[model samples]
Target: MPSGSLRGQVALVTGAGRGIGREIAIGLAAEGMGVGLVGRTHETLTDTLKECARHGSRGVAVTADVTRHGSVREAVRAVERDLGPVDLLVNNAGQVDRAEVPLWETDPNHWWQVIETNLRGPYNLLRCVLPGMVERGRGRVVNLNSGFALRPDGNYTAYATSKGALLQLSDNIADSLAGHHVVVLDISPGAVATDMTAGMPMFQDMKTWGSIPYMVAVTVDAARGRFDALHGRFIHAGRDNLEELVRRAEEIREADARTLRLRPYGPQDPMG
Candidate 1:
């Protein structure tokens, strides 16, 4: 909650080469977190390193493909060697293929690509990072899920389905790690302007939603654990009711914790 609360913390942001991931990496650095920028492109990763340096935080640019476990593992090791152990992990790498193709008409290769990047990538990072975090007993994980995760539309079968699965993954992680002081959450940026959408037809249609800066700010808050109250919940960007959304999430968590119902009596239950 205070400025620089993340000072001395090490944060790794995947896909930090550009777009929303770039902004999130820069934002974390600005908050005094040493940042590891992970992406497949060396050029874009270099840019992110410059941005983090400009913001006055130590940064390491690592070029790695998230879909490959070996690549991600090596990248994580490099970051740990350069910036110390990671205190935070942002699973932001994602891809959307065949955006115009319906589910039935989608190319199998394109569909698998989307799933690999969007879903498997996060799983790899979590698997690589969770052991260290659980050993330390303190860490934070933020998954950049999309608004489409909750509300899907036409022609986004691969992207939307992957994001929806990501949300569920975050939820499971939250439930499992709550006692470890490791918070896991899914954030929906709500149509921020990014290179991924810049030339798309939907870009013009969604330009009025919000810019990347606002989403970055919310993400920074999430990193500092300000939104711990909303773990296992979703938060939308550009909404006028963030406070209300957070309150609702807290209420939901509390309700779930308080209400425990028994399952229907099964054959295995002798008491039934």
Candidate 2:
């Protein structure tokens, strides 16, 4: 049965061809939302679209890359034309560092490519999608972020740096959308066993993996306003009880927890 509240609404999910993005698209569809599946591969996107249709949901697949602003704008237009104004935007398309190599040891082209795909991609989507949301006085954005953003890891410099920037971008956008009634969430799917993760050197030796269903559930809840209180806050799907977090949203927000920040060495330090 389709869940209530989301029926008839629309969602545009990037990287919907596979992995978490694929699952998220289907999850929203099951909840009765029209979905736009955006990805570089038409065949894979069409596969996801068909799955969404099985749930009796409307969907469209666009074979487009996220790194190009004009391409993203056109993609958004096509999705809106098919599924109505986007009520939710999921920036799920991203890549990780190719190998466990230090910054200088990494290939420069690959490093910049990662930067473009991870950081620039989300920025492009937001630029194209936010105006309508702001005008409508309602909408939500979910940026697939990571704990990597909160800490440093020399090996995955590009990936970590991009996510950290994205984290701040979400925080700033969330604050800007206060009066507009739009909320942005920075969430980490948390080591899900996707191809992206499979290629990651860190997850290769791990036996345990994050739950795709749990991650999907969190996304649906976010769309339905369950986690609106945690807007601009980082939500890790594999850890932290969501119910408990929601219950203490005010405390978390006031404490300014779960965001990237520079720690000062002393009270007199400017960063503090």
lDDT of each: 0.83, 0.92
Please provide, for model 1 over 23-80, each residue's C-alpha lDDT reduced to its tens digit, 9 standing for 90 to 100: 8898888889999999999999999899889878999999999999999999999999
All models, RMSD in angstroms: 4.5, 1.1
**Poorly placed runs, candidate 2 (over 4 Å):** 1-4
The lDDT, on a scale of 0 to 1, for candidate 2 is 0.92
Residue 155, model 1: lDDT of 80
Which candidate comes out best when scored by TM-score? 2
Show pairs that collide, candidate 1. none
Q: Candidate 2 versus the native: TM-score?
A: 0.97
Tell me the RMSD of model 1 versus the true structure. Answer: 4.5
